[model samples]
Target: MSKARLLLATERRAIVGLAGLYATRMLGLFMVLPVLALNADHLAGATPLLVGLALGIYGLTQAVLQIPFGMLSDRVGRKPIIAAGLGLFLIGSVVAAQADTIAMMIAGRSLQGSGAVAAAIMALLADQTREQVRTAAMATIGLSIGVAFAVAMVLGPLISSHFGLAGVFYFTAMLAVLGLVVLWKLVPPAPRRRGHRDVGIDRGQLKSIIGRTDLWRMDASIFSLHLVLMAIFTAVPFRLVEAGIAEPRHGLVYLGVMGLSFVAMVPLVIVAEKRRKMKLMCLGAIGTITLSLLGLGVAGSGLVALVGWLFAFFTAFNLLEATLPSMISKLAPAGAKGTAMGVYSTSQFLGAFLGGVLGGFLSQQFGLSAVFLGVALLAAGWFVLMLGMTAPKHLSSEVVVLSDEHQGDALETLMARFADVAGVEDVMVVPEERTAYLKVDRSRLDTEALSRLTGVRD
Candidate 1:
């Protein structure tokens, strides 16, 4: 196999810092998912509906604000927005720690979501790394999130069991503090402070991005995926307890299941990407999720059976989570990647909010099996939508920083020139930003031509 491209030393440092900052913040948010439903019963005004709301309240705020924040980062400095967001997250954590009611918990979680620094952080990462390595950097960040999620599932129950729910909130507050420190101390300064179309939301591209049917389907996929996730947790924790696992010992189950699921998922992911079977794999995973949910509802009375179904659910969930972003990257138009991702992310958060409310409502009214049944039906809907999706082409993005020499060129002229470049399938030139974005098939890329384009910058 050809050796992978290596990151520059500086790029390495920046990625580590940014990944750490992102992971710590996400860790703080996720550490409550698995334990909250079980522990929140003691809070005043607690109800299944309210608990679910508190569990997913962050997604509502996050969905509403991330795009705005990314756009704002173009005007103000990236660090300021990031720091301010972290401060809000810190305050929210403290508020939750002191809350005596589910209402307060909801308030705190909403505040936590309001931080919405994801876009700003991506912009910063783009500023720090060259285009060749930016995708890898983004992948690293994605991996960190997955890792944080898995760890949180295990840790949340353990901490809540030993120290109470307030302890988890307090721990998140400390994590926010640590995130702030990493942001400033470890993450390197961005070399340029400007809008990046590939990594930052572009207002001009929003309408176009939203109009693409394929992109919308990708967005819907994420929304369904996360909605099911948040909804499942609202009831699953209780089921584990009912199966005789103590609330405190819930982490052990998560650890075992998550570990095995990950191990089983790796080869499948490799097959999906390497063999060009993304569509087949995605469909299979969704089918697995539907079947697993059905199995859980029908025959999960025994602990062993319950664990088996849970493992299957998570394996499919993990695969979908890994593949969806990649599909977005492949299907999204070149220059509008940031805008496409912004819309996709908004859909994801909205799904989380709805999932929590709907899941809790079903569990409260009908029982735990009802929650699984409801989500299963929703997953079936997702599968149908996905079945109509055209297979995504294998493509990647290239960003070119325009030099002053291109200032006199017409936007159309520049775009035509870029489109004609060997292997480049699409091109977008924003003259105001003096940047060009291209979608290309790497195998067909003409290295000499690409070098000539970037080489023009002096």
Candidate 2:
């Protein structure tokens, strides 16, 4: 096999390892959902508002820390940051497990949220995989998250029933220990930051990316995505119980619907990617979400709400979850994928935090109807924002390793030459890593031309 092929295989293994690590963390957070309200009162001083604050604090910390942590990973290396984050997560889990008071539980959960690793994982994936295949690698990780989420929701009740919420924390701690092993045994060694070229984003790049109206729209779409997601969960479980399924059985309902929705998302994603119809898919998801929430706002029967609203919400949620990353991947300047994801992830966590807080407040003040109505409005706004977005033409980015000699003036000269290549949209020359990050139009760019100009073969 070729060297590039070997490297790709190695990267794929690393991605799988990382996927397991991600699943472990999410399982800890997700398994609490089925019974948070039921058991929270036992912790003392628990109210709906307090429960909401506890749930939302994780997102709040994650939103604040993910970008800096990700950028830090770029500088210090991926594994160290990942290990440190996982350690913090383990400590938080243990703290929560032993908490007798809601205040302590909230504090533990906040620290757990502070163990933000999404950015580091993404950066690692980017570092290991070439640009041409990075999206596919990313998609693998996304699949893991969705599957873990579904499985956790379904099993939350069963797990809690067997071991209690504290038991869940104990399990999470055990998994964190295993994660440390996986990090060492399975994760590939950090690709030497070549000094050939650096992929790190600076203040100027952030300013440029944020200034683009199109990018802003994409950010808004992500924020809206998570906001709607958290809002649905805020009310959906209660709606399920009101419909007749009891608290413990809600997990079964989530499991069933998510299973079917997971299957459905596959073909829809294939159609969107193959057809290059991201805008259409995005609009369709928003519309579906709006209609679903509207139905929930008006529906009188639990069954009617479940069939009309819950189904619509999950279907749309799964589809949007799959497409949003792809759209961001397409829209971001090729060399700036890390920066794009940093902003995207920050918005996502902020949305989750806001969703939980607002949903709680709305439900407390105006009833569930008001919460659904708010979600409907939010979805409507997303649909409008999406409507105004120009359809993104499909493209891919690649990371090319270069020799250390290609630094300074020589790298700039190479960058100038590479920029003039037909179909190249953006190029970042990193002298530190000896890598050139290239974003290109596949149809317009000549691959052979790139290979010849760069003196490298993929």
Candidate 3:
């Protein structure tokens, strides 16, 4: 195999490992979805509010710890941090499994939540792959999440019915153990690298990035993406059960709906990427989600609601899933991809927490209609916000790997090269990072010619 092909294979394996790890982690959380309220009441001192807290505390801790853990991975190494996080998760699962009261369960779940693996995963992927292929790597991980979520929704009730909620915890604990095994046996050892320089926020630079009205448009779009997602899921599972689909079969509906949605999403993704119409695709997804929410809010039949809402939900969900990260990569300050993602992820999780807590409270305080209405409002807002955002121009990158002695003129060389490359439209070179990033029009540049020009053989 060529070097690029070999690297691609390695990236694929790493992504597969990530899928397993993420699926295991997510399954533990999603297993509670079908039975949370019904099952929680049997435990000692359980209350609706406490149940909501338990449901959301994972996101809270996950949000808080992600960047810290990611930054820590820069020091302690990815494997060690990942192994440790999984161990913590296992411990928490065991604690929750054996808990005698709601308070203990919450504590155990909180501990489980503290095992934030996402940042470490991203950092590891970065270490292994070139920037050109990093997005593909990320997409693999994203697919894993989508599949894991589908599997969990289906299996949750079955596991709960057969082994009870504690059994679900036990299963999660076991999955963590399996993840540790994969980390040791399957994953390639990470190469040693210099620690990341602390990119202390520059007030002027920060203001430029954030103050750009266009960047805010993308940020708002992402925030709104997660908000609608959380708000809708707040009631979708319960709505499924109400439709006479029993707990065990909940996954079937999820699997079917998500399966179809995934299939449907592919064509659109192709058109967007190939035709270079990402902005249009993004807006279409938002509109679809809004209509789905409205349909669910008013549908008289369960089948109608289920089919309509799922179609709408997954259509938008998958599109945003793909688009948001791409936009961020294109939009962020060149060297601070990690920092930008940290902020984006934190916002995403915060939205999830607020959606669940607020959605639950609204459902309890008012009714199902009220829950849908809240979601519809959020989706509508997202749709309006997305209108102002522009599509990313292209997908290719201009990468410069600096030599030790050539550091002095690295930025100048990069700027000159950026101007020389036929398709290069913009450039950002960080001397501190010894990296030069370029955003270019792929169609305008013959990639083979450029690679030869740059001596970067594929």
The candidate scoring highest on lDDT is: 1
Off by over 4 Å in 3: 8-13, 130-132, 194-212, 403-410, 431-433, 446-449
Q: Which pairs clash (backbone N, Cα, C closer than 3 Å) in model 1?
A: none
lDDT (C-alpha, whole model) for all candidates? 0.88, 0.76, 0.71
lDDT of 1 by residue, 1-458 (tens): 21225677888988999898898899999999998888887889999999999999999999999888877777888898999899999999999988999999999999999999998888999888877678889999999999999999988988898889999999999999898888888888767686777787777888888899999988888999899999988889888878999988899999999999999999989988888799999999999999998887775558999999999999999999898898888888878888898899899999999989988898889999999998999999999988998988888888877777778988888888778779999988888877888899988998678667656422
Q: Please write out the lDDT profile of model 3 over residues 61-85, one tens digit for every residue.
A: 8888877787788778888999988
| Candidate 2 per-residue lDDT over residues 117-163, each given as its tens digit | 87787777767777556656777888888888788787776766677
In candidate 3 the C-alpha lDDT for residue 148 amounts to 77
Clashes of each: 0, 18, 1
Stretches > 4 Å off in candidate 2: 1-3, 6-12, 74-77, 126-133, 189-191, 194-201, 403-413, 431-433
lDDT, candidate 3, at 185: 76
Ordered from best to worst lDDT, the candidate numbers read 1, 2, 3
* Model 2 residue 275 distance off true place after TM-score fit, in angstroms: 1.3
Superposition TM-score, candidate 2 onto the true structure: 0.90
lDDT score at residue 422, model 3, on the 0-100 scale = 79
